[model samples]
Target: MIAWMMLAQAALLGLLGAGVTVAGIAKVRMNDWILGAAAIATLTLVVQIVASIIAPFTGSGPTGDPFEYWVYLVMAVLIPPAVALWALIDKGRWGVVALGVALMSVGVMVYRMHQIWFVQVF
Candidate 1:
């Protein structure tokens, strides 16, 4: 995994999480911003999937357990859509907050995956 790309993804997730959380706090419902953020986040993770696929060809591989990294990747990729669906179904303020929390959680997970890829070599 590329360190810079991981950092960029983390930054994006952090910003999106904060934005969604603030919107939720302001009593926002399931709107374009929230949905759009979710969509963007999901698409970025899909990009990560592609990057992971190409990493081996580029001579970059996780330093840590590949299984663990993959599990984190898969889980992080799943969160946005799941939360977005929940928000859409509930259409409630707390649902928005939940989506925000999920985004933040995925951010943290991505950071951890970065650590796994770059820091935990053994």
Candidate 2:
């Protein structure tokens, strides 16, 4: 629930999302950099999950109510892996497009995490 950490994650996700989009638009094939970006986003989500688990004990409160936290957790944990798996099933630009979508989702999740941790309402 650290404000700075959430902001940093959001910014990183935004940049990664933009990168993915540009790479896909340029007709770039699957590459290590794209995979690395996905990996980094996955790691960031994992860190967020861990932070959420420990937040209450550390006095970060309930993360703006229970329902919101659960929603965020579910999406954050599930989306990236699902997208990556689906993308890997094919070897084309659409795969990169899927990754772009996944990256965008991560950016949204980052913002949602920030809201759930700091905002007063859903």
Candidate 3:
């Protein structure tokens, strides 16, 4: 749970969410951008997971409770891909809606990751 990485993820998710919202509102089905964002989010999540795995052994063990962090990580890694795949298959505005939800979820997960790493409360 690197602080900088979490922050970066948060920023990316925030931007993605905003983009999705705007595109949805404008009734513009920008599948390319949505797909690109999903791909980037997945990559970022993978990097974060790898970093978390190596953190403990690299002398930065247990920044907070592992259980809490794992919950956030798992959700962050799973939700976007599921939504993206669903969106690709569902040929309607529902796809955009699903992508929008996924982007927002990623933003929330970023915050949860930050809390798990830095807040030291939950």
Q: How many pairs of residues collide in each model?
A: 0, 0, 0
Question: Residue by residue across 32-51, what tens digits does model 2's lDDT show?
Answer: 78888888888988887777
Q: What lDDT does candidate 2 reach at residue 100?
A: 82
Best-fitting candidate, measured by lDDT?
1
lDDT of 1 by residue, 6-119 (tens): 989998998999899999989999899899999999998999989998997889987788899999999999999999999999998999999998998899998888888886
Reference-based TM-score of each model: 0.96, 0.89, 0.88
lDDT of 3 at 68: 89
Candidate 3: Cα lDDT at 116: 68
Error of 1 at 52 (Å): 0.6
Error of 3 at 4 (Å): 1.3
- Candidate number achieving the greatest TM-score relative to the actual structure: 1
lDDT of 1: 0.91
Q: Write the per-residue lDDT of candidate 3 for residues 1-122, one digit (tens) a residue.
A: 57777788888887887787667667767478878888888888889889889988877766667888888888888988888888788856768777877887888887877876766444
Which ranges in model 3 have alpha carbons more than 4 Å from their true place? none
Give per-residue lDDT, candidate 2, residue 57.
Answer: 87
